[model samples]
Target: MQKYLILLAGCPCTGKTYLVNQLQQQFKDSFVITPDEAKILYAESIGFNCKAEKEALEHKVWQFYYGVLQLYMDAGKRVIISEYPFSDKQKRQLSEFAEQYHYQVITIRLVADFDVIWQRRYQRDRSPERHLCHIMQHYHYGDTLENRNLADDLITKDQFYQVCQMRQYDQFVLGNLIQVDVTDFTKVDYSRLLNELKQIVKL
Candidate 1:
């Protein structure tokens, strides 16, 4: 099995974590690198509660994210799994990194029905994480919702980031399978995904 970076590109709340968990268990050698999770763990270890509103904390978390990513990528060889909403630019950067390290890229992009995703969010516990409504606005807010904010005198970082995420999701679709509905996501269904990947990746 050749070393590869499995990019879990999808909209938020599309079960990337669930997919990563299963992948890690199936392939023990795989290094699942989740930037957000890593940042959270680092914060907890340091007795800090990193909030998005805090620019300094956000920067620190990103520092850790990039630092950890470079650290893992520097390691000899392993399957690196990441659930990032990768834009075209980021994908290009990833390609360059893979070329530099002689590692292949096997992206396992996942997607879902919008309504289904919204329902799942309602079933989950309340938290500071993304809300279904926010995600919906982010994904589909290209001309309609974005125009309202873009017309404003000043564009907030939050608005800019939301637009970036939407573009990234669009780029992912152009590269990966067309909207594979994961509305009724299950381990059995995930098994099919794995099997197909095993064929392509030959890992």
Candidate 2:
């Protein structure tokens, strides 16, 4: 099987994880590296006046993520990074990682209508202790309001969102990238994506 550094980048609730799972089932010798799913590990390490302890927990998650990344890379496993790539710095990090390992980068940028994603974001379960809780509620912890908008306009806007920004990819990466319009994923012809992937990474 061919080795691939597949980066599933997208906005919140854009189905990055769902796409990652789809790819894992489609291919062999594949492993997904997602630290977000490790929240269960953080659940036990947070709360009270233990801000320092919470920070430590977050650090450990990164350590665990990178450690697992090393193991999979060493084992020649096809790796998928299912994380939000919404910044130049974040996308560059994925590009650099692919370059450092001589692995061809296949960035599958998931996209959707701003309003669709915004609606989904608010409907999802967002506990106060979770990451980005402050940004989600637009209020600090233990704060409340009669009405709050859970959608973040800046992050949801494609023009400002780095991953969805086509010009940024032109500046940050040369090629071997494709966009998956997930606005209607269920009705999408996924075989088209597979054909496009063949053009770049030989997956």
Candidate 3:
């Protein structure tokens, strides 16, 4: 049987990295790919931070990651991709790619309270060359409670949350896709989550 692919998606500071690391400790054979790591590699190689140059470099970085993912899947290895797969477009593309390789793809979406996320983002440290701090600050400003009421009307927060919560393993068993919410992790029962995943993947 081909190895499975676990794709973790979430906003910045949502603990996707932590979860991936934990899972890797448990599953020694799994391969992991993280976009931030790719970005750092690309930045180091190409001297990132210049406006036009950084944009071009980032594009190349993602292209490289996509090719790397395909290479791993072709080798029949279990790969765990950690990134913010935020849109239907990305999900559809990844799903089609996995299907082409006959590899089962399991998507896990991590969610936390906005306040918790914002606080984490605020405390995160970034390299001097990376503008992530500024970017995150901007995101926090827009998503803050003071601005959320105004922003909430412009978007379907609950629907989006539900989508993230329900899109993981549940979607896969339906012969489609899978989404799980890691919100309330402190109270979450990991054993139940593991059992549900095993059933979905028939492990």
- On TM-score, the candidate that comes out on top is 3
* Candidate 3: worst-modelled 10 consecutive residues by lDDT: 133-142
Q: How close is candidate 1 to the true structure, as a TM-score?
A: 0.66
**How many residue pairs clash in model 1?**
0
* Residue 80 alpha-carbon offset, candidate 1, angstroms: 1.4
Determine the backbone clash count of candidate 3: 8
Q: What lDDT does candidate 3 reach at residue 125?
A: 34
lDDT of 3 by residue, 61-101 (tens): 77887888778878878644445544453566577778888
Please provide TM-scores, in order, for all candidate models, with all chains considered together: 0.66, 0.66, 0.68
Off by over 4 Å in 3: 79-81, 125-185
Per-prediction tally of clashes: 0, 0, 8
Local accuracy of candidate 2 as per-residue lDDT tens digits, 87-191: 465565556555666566677777777677766665553444434422332323343333334533223344434444554432333236677777776876677
Deviation from native of the Cα of residue 50 in model 1, angstroms: 9.8
How far in Å is the alpha carbon of 130 misplaced in model 2? Answer: 9.7
Task: Report lDDT (CA) for all predictions.
Answer: 0.57, 0.57, 0.57
Error of 1 at 138 (Å): 22
Q: Residue 30, candidate 3: how far off, in angstroms? A: 0.8
lDDT of 1 at 192: 74
